[model samples]
Target chain A: MRKITAALLITGLVSAGFAAKEEKKENLFEKKLMQDIKVLNEKIENLYKLHVKECAPEYIAKAEAYLDAIDGMSYINPDTGQIERTEISPMDKIIFENKARKYLAIAKEKVYSDADGDGIPCYQEIEQGTNPFEAEKKVSRAETEMKEQKVSEKPEVKKVGYQPLKMHARIHFDFDKYNIKKDYLPYLNVITRYLKAHDNLKIKIVGYTDSIGSKEYNDRLARKRAEAIKKYLIDHGISPDRIEIIGKGKEDYLFDNNTPLNRFTNRRAEFFVMEPTESQ
Target chain B: MRLLTAVIFSIFLTAGSYAETTTTELLDEAQNSIKAAFESGCPTYAPYEYYKAETYYRIAREETSKLNTKAGDAAAIKAIEWALKAMAKRYGEE
Candidate 1:
């Protein structure tokens, strides 16, 4: 009699286990949506590894959306008065679909014109009317005219290189400080000019510090510096995350750290050329 | 039968609680790492600061496993908060 009772109990337990997983099993869309989020996250992570820092913000935003969607899908089981998944709720499906569409739109824009879809969205096929990519052709012509004017006006100096992306002065800071010393902020005007001109290319205000203290401490200070720069950029109208923070502790320095002056040189941060990739 | 149900429920709750604790701990560690990076690179933000922040953010996010019941939500939220805080401190007040 005890043996029979044990077998019956085992079967009941197994059934309960199945019941627990049943909702997840039935929800095909939810499963696929979750998979998509993971795939997107992986793609972004891989690109960052390749030193493609400029494209990271858009990807990060997408990843955040995916996480939010997953969390929003929790369902309540009416019968048990407890929460249980019943496939995906309609609300959850709509949220995911909308977000997916937005991401796809961004991906499509990458192939044609700018990443932000500014001014023109994309260059449409001739048969499809106005091409967004074609807008660049006008920009190129204008740039050539401006260059010619500058050359003719100066008739000296000599122009060279593949049309410089416009240079800007990157401000460096002292250890653990965020104030834009009255002297440093002026140089940022150079950055402002570049932004005003290109309006497309972005800047990454990376922060750095020397390797003096514990590995963890320097890292935190470096982040503070980067954040200070990022906030500055946003105030100047650049989008957040467009300006990235990179903190380097004593590990990577341009000059030797033995002397105070050399250490000072090592304790500086610089701006990087942040042009959009052709891959968008 | 009631005992078995209780056991399963207890296991789920315990797992959830454990996951929550780890997420918080990882975030604390990451915050410290960011702080260390800053002090080490003193006088200016160095290149490695970015690498450290990236690593911390990535690890915190990765900790969100399938077993991470809430589907990594808590971890992701906490990580992002630290990332922004780190950014503010590095960059400037807007």
Candidate 2:
């Protein structure tokens, strides 16, 4: 009877151990999904700003497409063990929808005006003094054809032999939080190994934010996020002092601000590895 | 007299090994807990708390290596707790 009890106890302990391990894995997966959602939201916001600032009227269609794409994304629900899809969680959907609606309404208002005092809407009329649609006047097909004729007449220039150091790398972060995601540990491990293998390597991490808030706020947030990434590197056996963090905020627009879809390109973390002795 | 001494020495060695094993297990559990907290989003923790968690984890790992089971186990548990606390604070968790 004592032997049987001992066997039973060991069996119970082993089963419990396996159950705990499985639970831990499930939690990690959920965290990863949340991180992805956070990033997606930031991207949507960033793209919208870029569309507004750079493309103007073109952003309307881009914004719509982005929203459509966002709505189409789906993920496996860790809790339910099923798939689920939504542009944003019910908690976040209202905030984002309101933001999108605000931008769309403004864009429509600016682009379409009842200029002729008719009930029908038309494009905004230009003031007699101010320039008209810049795209219309900026270039002409006749001028392009003339330029192409001239370019064809000239000899092709030799390609430059200079090789640029490959600096571009994408870093992942957890949802709504600036902390580095655990999945990045593998990439970081590779980076560390590469650096240790190559003593003369120099790198710079540029952090940025989607254009959602004031420029100043985004700037601070970007800097903090970058610093956090640098800290993670230090914690993971990398030399802390060597890494540099730069915050560009919304100054560097990767996408248009017209729609949620286009804005995603702007919310990202970029790493630029430089050749040793390169100027900062 | 020598035989008695041998028996006492053997008992001490066995006891030491048992204590060491217990501490090692505790430290392992603690480390696992810390990882679990981090994996769970250390939701409320300030970055400093994660840093503290790492510090305690290292201490635990070090002590465990040295066979200082008691301190090692305590440090490991503390490390995991700190990690969770940091995440919880960051996430605004109760």
Candidate that would win on lDDT? 2
lDDT digits (tens) for residues A1-280 of candidate 2:
9999999999999999999999999668556655654655575465444333222333343333233322443434333556555332332334334444554555556444443343333332121111122332223345345546644553243132111244345563332357776645676677777766766655567777766778888888778778886787777666765677798877655444443322344555766554543222
- Candidate 2 segments whose C-alpha is farther than 4 A from its true place: A1-164, A172-176, A278-280, B1-94
Task: Tell me how far the alpha carbon of residue B69 in candidate 2 is from the true structure, in angstroms, after superposition.
Answer: 68
Candidate 2 per-residue lDDT over residues B39-90, each given as its tens digit:
7655222434554566556655654676654445555655666667766754
Q: lDDT by residue for model 1 over A1-280, one digit each (tens)?
A: 9999999999999999998778766577567776776665665455444322222334334444444444453433223445543223445445545665565345434434443344543322211222232354554457457746754664244232112244534455655565665556755666766666776666655566765667788777777776776677678877664565677655555444543334444555666646654433
Model 1: residue A74 alpha-carbon error in angstroms: 77
TM-score of 2: 0.31
iRMS of each prediction: 13.0, 21.5
